[model samples]
Target chain A: MATVNWRTINIDALDPDSPANFDLSTLTATVAPVSTADVQSLAGQIRQLLRGGDNEGALQGALENPPYGADERGKDVHLATVIEILQSIRQSDMSPMLGRIYKSPGGTEALDVLMKYIYKGMSQTNAASTTRNITPQATGFSQIHSRGGGEGGGQAMSVLLSWHEKVVEIAGPGCIVRVMTDRRTV
Target chain B: MGPPEVHHLFHHPIADHSFSADRQTLAVARENNVDLYQRAGGKFQLKDELTGHDKTVTGVDIAPNTGKIVTCSQDRNAYVWEPSPQGWKPTLVLLRINRAATCVRWAPSETKFAVGSGARLIPVCYFEEEDNWWVSKHLKKPIRSTITTVAWHPNSVLLAAGSTDGHARVFSSFVKGVDSRPEPSAWGERLPFNTVCGEFLNNTAGWVHSVAFSPSGNALAFAAHDSSLTVVYPSAPEQPPRAVISISTQLLPFKSLVWSSESEIIAAGFDCEAYRLQGSEQSWQLAGSLESKGRPGVQDHREESALNMFKQMDLKGKVTDDTKLKTVHQNTISTIRVFEAGAGTVRKISTSGVDGRVVIWTL
Candidate 1:
């Protein structure tokens, strides 16, 4: 008698990637797609607000409507605007800004959107550092840090990390879980 | 309340479990087989095993009115087990799908059942008297990914399905011959077969793990992978829902949830412990964990001897032994079902987990 080890076989590899097998429409956002021009205009407005020292307005504008249905380029533009707004806020004003965002109508959802951008910013910075291939200085007690970063990149990472910490402190850990599990792109 | 009653079965994950209407027999889906345990002297003894599926059994449900058992497996097949004098006889269901069946639930009327599958469709199977076999009609439209879990409405016509596409949808599985015209409700009127009554996406578009209809069939609740439970109350047919309340928890995501009543829901999953959420259709909040921690004598059971402390420090480089969690279930809970109900409210509930322990909690 002969028996085949069906479990060990790569069944998924054998199957063709067809629409009937996996529907792509379900994975995409149901919202209408955002055009590149619209994203650019929004980025310009957010940049103007940032320059005017309206950090809260800029952050709120960046988070109010995520480019859920945008293409990769459009989403990247929106993400860059969000990071610029996140970086413009003073360290002391971070808690108060988050508190105001949390207290406002639909503030919790805005915070969740902000969290998604924060994670995206962190990953992009990390990726840039890796591509640059900057060697770490072998200082005592700091060699234990595994993430590679240059001096400028490390400061940016610290800012993002502190924002992440404070976001979790205000929004609770659910924001992190939401950002990690959410499939809809920012 | 007192501590929950726990029975540690064999060391294997139980994907799903169901109790008979009389609550005398318990059926659990273990690895390739469905094991039946008889309730004897306040303990469950292994009675028999229904072994037919070649792959892992994903779901098992026992019909309440009729003592029939329905089991679906990852082998892309389903079986309806009928008790006979000789033994339990298994009848294969013609699912007509090429992918694994992930979950199964018998309709309240016991005339039909729905199987959620990786084929991105739900096959509503009903017995054909003339052919003397179980035939299925697929609900294919609007379903995008593998269905994770399915639930039947109290009327037996409406079915709710949760899928990996981050959607919980309510579809009419009204088989023309098997099911009668259901009464008009918030879901819809003149329910035809494959009618899309409602579709709800999770807040962050997380994969929905479990979806359930309320006891009254007027509301729907689903647990998603983002550690949130959302409850939707349909206002009127073709209109927006009156309320879609999502309660996010700090704990791990819930894999299974059951409505104890119209106002209360008990959910358990990766948290290893069950939690209770209570409120109305307008708003809801997490009440707390069902487990009452720091029970008397539980703390005393841990031995803090110097030798044990030294052994712990030498082995794991830690002074305290934190291997054991405070919760009863040592691993992720996979399923939660109502064990006993009275007067439209669940009195006791049962939960099984990866720890191979079945616990009964009085709510």
Candidate 2:
């Protein structure tokens, strides 16, 4: 096989080991303050909404909390939690859900909206450096700024790209391209 | 002591490779054809191309003693090439399988060979004297899924197969007129065709990628998709194996592995590095990696000037040179073979990877 830029994992399509199995309660005690179970439950709700032909609702669900830029210095914790949750969802039974969504009415449009959010979120995270400009200077006292620096933003973008790759792998190249390039509708 | 011999052949993935007895000629299955490379003073040159197969050639084996080349492909066919006064003559073997042939191995005796196929059966083929053509008998029992790899025992009768069904099974391919029944080993006493001597599974039930037999033919080792290596030593047929020890690693799944020596094994795969695993029947553990950490004296140590940084930012997105991996192979190592071995141990090993490079490493 050729060397792919990203890692390829094969979760048995039939018996998928979903990311929902991740223990968020224990992880919250040590690292991020956010509840992982909440994100897992959110992904579950988004999956259900997408399956039920409510693609807009699913997109809204992903962007509502936004997972970052809300609390002070919460960007790293939020981004890491969101990335983990999306990665786990990628391991779920995605093909069937994607297929069912595409079969529903205005499904392509819904997929396009989701793709727009993913693409935009990834770009925003990559450009996180430009978003924050509090350079660390040599001083006993640290400068406090209203805007947080791009600490975990680039990693968040990378994780978003990883999820995008998995989604493309399941949805097929043509479908992904169609959704990605559907400009006027979005 | 020194760096391995590296040859960047082509852009396509090399499915399999075989070296001639004299070590002068190399045959590599690239795409639908096999390219033959001849060694000159220091480098190998493209000599010939075997272009009979219509589909992707999956496996290639060159019998050193007989100087014969056999290739199998995804087109559900196999061909045997014999060197003649004029050129290499191709004789098509009647491998009556509908699905693609996955792997092929020449037996020790050189009288027969085995072809693993997607049809869930292995075709143990031998040349029919009366017809002057190769004929095969299918080993159809107990195979649950597509056979990924086949390793022939030194005795030639016992064939070990690793399949997608997460099982490594040893079957007897003893043909009636091919040979005379001889000694009884730990595998079995009554040798018959398709007799499964021993069947082993990966601890995590992962797909078996590669299976190999020790030089002494006493131990069997297999690598699975779970990034674990299981070594099995059989005591007798229909009985629990003497020992089945599994060593799991944190590295990516290993696509290929070879027994460098009785106590050492070299496995390489998705990690882009070949690792040394050392031990015996009782227990086994990972030794260090076979690759050097970084490119010595080849670092881009030039001071990061503003102009260079701007140039780098304009050309590629990343400021650092993350394109090149530290290892010699930039991709997964697909096949690893004992390049040179003697006294029941391998002295040198060869690895071909998706990066279109073939490397020979001294152990």
**lDDT tens per residue, model 1, B163-273:** 988899999999887888889999999788999999998667899999999999999999999999999999999999999999777677999999999999999998788
Give me the runs in candidate 2 sitting further than 4 Å from their true place.
A1-186, B297-310
Mind giving the per-residue lDDT tens digits that candidate 1 earns over A31-119?
78899889999999988988898999999988998989899999999988888787778889999999999889888788889999888
Best by TM-score: 1
Which portions of model 1 show Cα errors greater than 4 Å?
Answer: A1-23, A26-29, A32-58, A69-74, A88-100, A134-149, B297-303
Give all candidates' CA lDDT scores: 0.90, 0.77
Every candidate's CA RMSD: 5.0, 16.4
Each prediction's DockQ against the real complex: 0.44, 0.02
lDDT for each residue of candidate 2 in B34-73, tens digit (9 for 90 to 100): 9999999888899999999999999999998999999999
Chain B TM-scores across candidates: 0.96, 0.96
Over the full model, what C-alpha lDDT does candidate 1 score relative to the true structure?
0.90
CA shift at B258, candidate 2, in angstroms? 0.7
